[model samples]
Target: MSLSDCRILELPRISDPRGNLTFIESDNHIPFGIDRVYYLYDVPGGAERGGHAHKQLHQLIIAASGSFSVMLDDGTERRTFFLNRSNYGLYICPMIWRELHDFSSGSVCMVLASRKYEEEDYYRDYAEFQEAAEKRG
Candidate 1:
């Protein structure tokens, strides 16, 4: 509903002399159950993605490698989050418009979604998203 509703979550980290490890479990490390998992990679410089909002979907976005920023707008407020760590993730709620941009080379953006992909659940147009957000509010 608002930018305040979005939060950065810290995942479990296991440090070892060999290598550091991070793990995430559905509804354990994230607020919602994970029904889908995907990642974005090989993004060219200055390119952008995710210019839409979901009606009832929730997602946890993490930077598994390199770095990137997510711009979030919740109808009334806007905020930007820089994700560069595999042990941290950004939790996005429904009705919030999100855009992913400013990706560094070799950046891997991983997303854990609450539900499987459905075209009807997406609000791709900003104007329509604003109207839907207003109605929900």
Candidate 2:
């Protein structure tokens, strides 16, 4: 998929006097089925995560608490998305390189993925990802 396939998705939310609640359903809130779920937390200041691209995985990343920024690179162009709200998610398609950075203190980045862990599905090198993107382009 291209960078154009990446977008921000708003999730369903309910507000009450005490607190707010958010929920996501597979293939309803996101474009794919949920196969894995994970989160990043307690990230030290200036620490960065996700310097890779998935060959076939689709993902929805949400800032469950606090804030962070996601930088997407699609061989020829780049875009940065700032995420702070709990009810919004960033949907990422396959073959796009993503880097998560500028995380606020105690931030939690929750990810709902379309595929389970598969080391062969990852492009951990930017140069390799770029090369593959170019060939596919």
In model 1, what is the error at residue 50, expressed in angstroms? 0.3
Per model, state how many residue pairs clash.
Answer: 0, 0
Most lDDT-accurate candidate: 2
Clashing pairs in 2: none
C-alpha RMSD (angstroms) for model 1: 0.7
Question: What do the candidate models score in CA lDDT, each in turn?
Answer: 0.94, 0.97
Query: Can you list the residue pairs that collide in candidate 1?
Result: none
Local accuracy of candidate 1 as per-residue lDDT tens digits, 1-137? 67799999999999999999999888888889999999999999999999999988999999999999999998888999999999999999989999999999999999999999999999999999998888878
lDDT of 2 by residue, 1-137 (tens): 79999999999999999999999999988999999999999999999999999999999999999999999999999999999999999999999999999999999999999999999999999999999999999
- The C-alpha stretches of model 1 lying farther than 4 A from their native spots are none
State the lDDT at 22 in candidate 1: 94
Candidate 2 residue spans exceeding 4 A from truth: none
